[model samples]
Target: MTGWRIRDYHADDVDGILRLWEQMLAVNADPVYGLSDVLASCAKDHAVVAVVGDEVVGAAIGRAAHAQGWVVFLATAAHVNGTSIGSSMLAALESRMAAVGISKLSALMPAAAQARVGAFLQQGFALKQDLHYFERHIPVQREELKILAELGGRVLPRGLWDGVGGMNAEKDLLERRVVMPLAQSELADRFGVVPPRAIVLFGPPGTGKTTFAKAIASRLEWSFVEVFPSRLASHPGGLAGALRESFTRISELEHAVVFIDEVEEIASHRQGEPPSPTQGVTNELLKIIPAFREQPGRLLVCATNFIRALDAAFLRHGRFDYVIPIGLPDEQARWAIWERYIPDAAVDIDVRLLVEMTEGFSPADIEYAARKASQSALENAVSSGAEDPEGPFIEDYVAAISATRATVSAEVAKEFREDIETVGRL
Candidate 1:
């Protein structure tokens, strides 16, 4: 017998799953789902398929709402019908649903389908003859998301923002300017408040501008669509057309937070004798921004390390709602970053001393020093053959701090301060 394995469904499995669904219906089972419905369910919901080599031998599809879960489709190949495939597939689907906080799982099938109903019974599903299954279908917007995915856009997990350690001011600004307006759209509209459509996050390198943009998406519970200039450069219409098409598809989503990092690559100032090559792309972006702003339920976040390099018109009043700066971490932020990097141990390490010593370090710089300290401690422990090695000592951290270089130089920091004073719009 060929070895079989269960795994998450992929786009490639669509054909196999369709064939499997056809085979099940051929056996006089109820035919309620269309091909598009099945494909959409597989795309946006939790689905698993059992495969022997590349051939799908069994499958289960599920979705969760509130505290209830529904197994929309389940099937096994005729060759493997009597084997444990059916029960195993159900178990896998239930496990996935349970992970997402679904406590009740129910299935619907016609009374004549004994074999299909038996599979559910074997997997602990009770027969509810007293109850009836009724569903009012909602139109699936998954097709729009499918197009977005093909354009390299994705819906990121909400947990990402929680991982951002510090920069409380940046976080607060994002919440008030972006998250609050969108999340409380009805409330804000009632008070005659208009939600911002575009914002710019400007700062020195390694200050977590991109991180804040992603966190805003997470906080708003919206889909994230990052337009990659390099990826779009290969399109037939070139970079400018690719960007326009990407935004066109992105507008299909009900709610989205679009991001363009290192935006100065295309939006830089057009001054100089020969004129810049990116001037056309800059003009295209400016045109796209106004149209994007006219639409509700979307926000554009652009991040740049050198805000001064951008074209002056790009940062003008109507183009962006806010131009916020994300500077180097303060003492409290540094302490948070330090404490996060240190592992839990029986012995306490002096993190305040480490924080004080690395006053000029960015979050990334501090993380590097912490990793270096842990690495050196581990190497020493292994070399010395210490059985009960204690945690990284303060001295270990001190040595790492002395050796580690800060990413932000004093000169660059001074320049950043000047830029904030002169050009900052927050």
Candidate 2:
């Protein structure tokens, strides 16, 4: 308690610092800054130690950025005069850092270290009340940035899931089956629930399959990379080789949602005596899936308008966790779609009537019709030399509905229902 001296840290003080750090951890379950960070700062930043005859008893570490200074670590052995020792070490650290024009000194002491508060308060440090610490851990790390750029992938912004309008049924299914497990992976593992690594989104053309894929990525805050089969066709290694290379690069990413739209083109049934032209590409993809599943923190979303045309082996249980149906929008879904396209200025528009007329319309069909209605109305307004600030009227919408052809036929809708019953896993 009596023979303690405080001075600037030296290279030999590392062992003394380690001893104090381990002693603090033995008592407190949590320490804000990691041992590595504290040790690194001790070597490169401002630091001081209190020793009893060359045996270290206390230490204070700090760093300054701009005018603000942070007390990264403060600790003293139990046998020493802790409060007096801590205050002395802190004062020494402040003096060492004072040369850099530091205006304010702060300590991020965790709740477990409340006993050490006396040292800070005694050094004229005020305890901040009603203040919360907020931090966002970025999903992509620095090393993965180059790989993501090469793959033309990016982390999508938030709110896309809500912006999807309706399709609540599809959204609900994906949220529970795909998103919940992956987002809460630890909890899922506790319950022995394995998150889906890959899934097939199947439906008739223009049912927003691609939209759902991107929204899933956005919802999970993972990087999105869409692999285009047509683009890969021109690769010098050929489509199969290009497909293999793309996935190999994808493996380097820590977290990603890889999308392949119109997958039927590359994954069609491999049959016939001479073997189909895309058979090699299909074989390459089949091999890729098993390897992709082995790696964690990745999801493969393959969308196909013609699910029936896909190879039977590709849809097996181990390869894809779910085979979901993204069919035409139902009543509620159609209403949401109309709501999305309707301009805020078009207050007089009849949404109910428009929804009724757009039944059996694919989401793409609804969007196309809405755009056409606005265009026709614009032409009418301009040609007549009159301005209608209220955008398109209900009549304009009705006319557009009549003119627009549904992307999905009645027959296609019936088949999709049948496919869901037979092939759907969810």
Candidate 3:
């Protein structure tokens, strides 16, 4: 009565096929088809399915060659049990085989499914005897292989340090404090008798520590590994495993730069309180850092907002040898920062004046000033009802400069500078 419709196999049919296969195996003691075999057959063949409305009541799996007969998977839903569905599905397959000039038909069925095999035999098909199946056990090197269990599957693109506005002194400090030792073979040999020192970049918020870390990595043409502290705390025991996997992956690259941003979040010491979940994570990192340092061609750069809060042990000589402070951008650097922000804007404004005005401002502060200045220019153009409203004038910038205040207070900058000067003598 043509109650069922048959069509070629679609990729969407895989879940249905697998569910049916599993259901049939549960109903009957034996299953003629299995998930792996079905998948393998689909990989090698042009499969087809028999559908009654939206549901797959039956399926035919087979592969064809030029002269030889085709081997096919014939299966039907267990719910439609013993309704000649299997026979009909096999007949449809046989017709396709005959159209392809195949002289015989064959399939792999369990020895216990003799009734099903006899049904196929009745359809003018015979089992060939000469095929012998064998399996081999090939041991893979566990040490050399990397099985990355995605603790967190979200992939962020490796951040490039190209857009940082201005931090010349910080950049210069990093180049001397971190990059130079690693770049020179003699210096590396003289310093440790083996490897270069690991440097830590510490500063207050918005001081461009992460940006500086990326710049050092980029300048050295090293592979960069950016680790977010939050991600490290996501899993309970996964931090160590993830770190090991990451280290293994990084080792493949000749020169790798591993950057830990906001390092204090993970490695900071807990004072006047009990240890929390993240306390264990920092301890694990402390253990790994030494091993990481032992490995050649690897540079570890850690950035943090609060350096004083970090574990005293973590800041010791072997692990994070140098603690380079990334303070507020200096006066000349602020001027350069201003120039960067107002690239094409026509301004008779003195850069030194802008820099002096931004005395206690960080690099981020200077950039914000530039943005505010540009916005002021646009507002002035609009208010004046100028013919070309797009152009920002010098007066707009001067007004913007006059309006904004320094981000860091003079008292705070002086106190910080005093602390640095006192610490420098030690």
Candidate 4:
């Protein structure tokens, strides 16, 4: 006869439950329910323990709903191997939960827990085949919502990452360098890859630097907070003190992606005479970055139209992991951008021609041209009093493209390529 006898779990048996949980992990029999859940069941739900005198060596925890009972946890101490203690505990746990009028008892365990399957079956449990488990964890918690609202941060919509049309090169680069490391941090760590804490996105104006920053935050499902230099300057502490306070509050969040667009305005090169008024702000930012890097699961993306104008020390090795270039869109990217702005109902618009014509246009320029074309078409159709006013025609778009001035001039584009070679770090 077995020396161990099954009984209802008591507060004194808590130490024994913890010991068994450790052994279960050692054997790769991963529990579906976490330790906290098992502990709660022992206190408020159904639990049974197998004890030899006052020392417990086995435990089974279960919880019941309207008609279903689930084995939350089950395990026998390593010292009591090749015995029926596990099966006995399961039987006792099931009996205790039966008061809830459960029609059936079930269990969810990792595939690694097969070593204990025999014990479960011995207790009249049947195994199911061809089953799988899927889980998704939301990044933010309810309690964090208040902190986020106060910080003027938000959780961007799910599709923003995918919705960012065109700029394939920039997208692919950020995905590998920033998103992959942060999203798959554990996997990255296995290969000795330190997840990036900060990065710089530099290019000419209207090249979609800010869009990429928001997309990175969206892809990671982290809070996105854009720090406006102009807005911070109006704070009572001035730009420097306000910047410090902003980051201090940001530390309260579990994970965040902080963006500072036009960072050059605050981090510009310190120059000449009695020093620029912005130099102190730049010095404060330099001090803030190291502290920011110490925290995991945070990324600071700073974008600048003029990389040359940024202070040298601001983009140093330890401060930012990568300084990537987001340049003008290519033909394929232009085609994709054009497709985004085109109306679904618009017929025979000859988009390929429009794409060909807007060779030097930016995303902002494309959006402007697309909207202008629709407005002009609507005005013409109204003025002529047509029976059915169709969507904007190719001729309307062509005129719009001709009228719209590209944001990046040839001189600016040339300087951007030069900055890419000299200033780009990726």
Candidate 5:
């Protein structure tokens, strides 16, 4: 058995801690705060370390100010894995903070650090739900950004920006319906039941499936992993490798959200047709699902445009636990969608008329209309050489509204609604 001891940070242990921090950053690529900064912060008596036979096995450094505490660094030596030393060190730190009348604590961690973050949460840290750290490096020259853009990678825009729109409702639903229930249910203690059940969100394209996935991940404080189906099938038996990697990475994440957009291409069930040699992909994925279920803090979400085309096997219990039908927005949801996209421009616009006209419109359709309107207004202003122009005029919105027809025709919507009703009755 490995022995463990917790002690104050010491000058002698600086080198070992530095090595541990370097190893952590190497594996995670998190920006370094430098050894001098860490030492200066530790001098305030907020640093603690776990030593296993003269080697620093685990450590946590934090600072307290104005009754709030922040955890700046936490790491465990890679060689001393699975000792629960990291968890113990966190507990000790929490206890120490409590002694000083500090109860609230926060930390910034990479998405890959889910397991370690989970250890902290288990020790009674209340996660701040919203707020994610998204960073992209800036090249030395603007030309580099242009080159990156040409290669189809996005260059970070100057300054930090939150994604457009709000997630309050989504956050509330995730916390109340998913996170809190899972936390209090029997799943809380049973690793086999703790991992989020595989769920399928199927609906019209651009209906916010991807956004909903990210919001859920954020609300639950789960690391989100987005997988591209095209890359999953690049090799012979490559699908298996890809699926395994996704599950393995999520397992390591310890409360991760694995979202597969356009999932029908991968997990779709095949029946009555000749077996595909690539059938190994489905088999491999099926096997991994159970393994993920056995691990705590893993969530697998699949979104698709066609639900009926999917294999019945995938819909069976223990595979995809829920098949959520994300249909086109209802009248109320359409109004909300319009309000979200055209916040300022909607001041004088008849939102009720817009919603009524867009009876069959999906969330994506509404957003598209708003954006098209905005673009049209910008172009008109530039062409006219106006002294001043407002963003997205009502007339422009009306013009954009007239340009496109509803994606979900009335006949199609009726058929879908009836089919769902029939299924629910069954």
Candidate 6:
């Protein structure tokens, strides 16, 4: 029991299961077992097994075909009961099914295996009131499926957008200005609305501007590929040429939401005497935007903490479709952020009090305070060796909140307000 672990099924497990089944037979335990069936199940579907001391003790098999999934096999040695190995194997199988977009899973088992159904039930698998399993086997080319994975340059999980707790106005604006057009291109075109190609996200540092850019890509289900000026400066033809070459590669993808955070590194104002080193790169980026816009399924989202520092031409109407501001979270947004990071076990905690105390805090600042409180709570629990550890108390949160510093200083907030009044397009 000390060394037992549940893991993916290996090819050698076939013989091990056969041996286990033989041993069970001597004890008058009978199971509908066959070598060919087990072999085929392992080869064609998601299969996992429990192993203890160099022997396979249990197995669970599942297959996901499009949106429908099936649990075809489940077995565990009688000797391993109460070890929790059966439940773990079922969980692994369910996880694999969900990963591939399978929404529903059903199982059909022999009467002899009915005792093992408890494991599946414990893990949230429900008994279908009236259902039957049927199949129509079809040969598929596995290589063709690889093309789906290859199309996206850097596919981001859709869950990231959901985790971005606060900043509702910014999220709603991006959804309207960017996601709507791309997600409903056909409908947008019918309404004589052109899908947006480029937009600039401007705000003070640590305001979740970069997070919003990635969230937009996640919301659209498009690949996210960020272009870093620091890395591009090391390329052969210098930053300008590197910028050109990077977009050329990006253009190959069918759907992409490209990001350029801290874009001011290259797109800053071209000044005086001899001209800045960034001037040439800024020019190259200007030239790339029109060509990038010509492509139907692409969006170029640039983020800059210093909106005022960007070259005048770079943010002009023809160049960027919109210039949006992602300022500090409003009161409602702050409440959402607090709810997200606050631990559930902190029962009867005054969320409204926490929210009120967190005024003038950026999303990053609020997150920091929440984390610090959590860390303090964890440290207290560890030191006390308490079995049921308490969560961050109100006083603990106030202390953490007092210690944390806001990323957006007063001067920066004032500057951002000026930019919103003067430069913001939305």
Best by lDDT: 2
Q: Model 4 compared with the native: what TM-score? A: 0.70
- Candidate that scores best on TM-score: 6
List clashing residue pairs in candidate 6.
none
The residue-by-residue lDDT of candidate 4 on 1-426, one tens digit each, is 357788998998899999988988988776788999999988998988888888888888888777677888888877785337777677666655655556577887788876567777665566777532221233565556677888889877555789899788889989998999999999999999999999999988888999999999888879898898898888998999999999999998899999999999999999987877699999999999999999998999999998988999998899999999988898888999999988876768887898899888888899899999988888988988889878678888999999999999999999989988897888
List model 3 lDDT by residue over 1-426, tens digit each: 247777877888888788767765765536444568677777666577778787887787766665454444566775564335665566666555545545445566655444455446544344555431111111111221222122221112222444455676666666565677666758777777444547777666677777787776655545466766666545455765566666656555456677888888778884545766567667778888888887877788887666667777777776766667777887767777778888565546666777777777777777777788787777777788978556455565666677777666766566556646533211
Which runs in model 2 stand beyond 4 Å of their true positions? Answer: 1-130
Q: Estimate the TM-score of every prediction.
A: 0.69, 0.70, 0.56, 0.70, 0.59, 0.71
Off by over 4 Å in 1: 1-141, 273-275
Which candidate order results from sorting by lDDT in descending order? 2, 4, 1, 6, 5, 3
Model 2 agreement with the true structure over 282-323: per-residue lDDT tens digits:
999999999999999999999999999999999998999999
Per-residue CA lDDT of model 1 for 1-426, tens digit only, reads 458889999989988998887888788877455667667889998999999999998888888887677877777888876336777787677756655656477777665456666667655566776432322221113454566567666555534677788778777777777788888999999999899999988887888888888888776657788887877778899788888888888778777889999999989998776655578788889999999998898999999988889999999999998888899999888888888899875156887788799988988888888899899888887888888888677778899999999988999899888988887777
Check candidate 1 and list the clashing pairs: none
Q: Is candidate 1 or candidate 3 better by lDDT?
A: 1
lDDT, candidate 3, equals 0.63
Kindly report which residue stretches of model 6 are placed more than 4 angstroms away from their true locations once superposed: 1-41, 44-153, 385-387
Q: How much lDDT does each candidate structure score? A: 0.79, 0.87, 0.63, 0.84, 0.63, 0.77
Query: Residue 238's C-alpha lDDT in candidate 4?
Result: 91
CA error at residue 71 for candidate 6, angstroms: 10
**Model 2 TM-score on a 0 to 1 scale:** 0.70
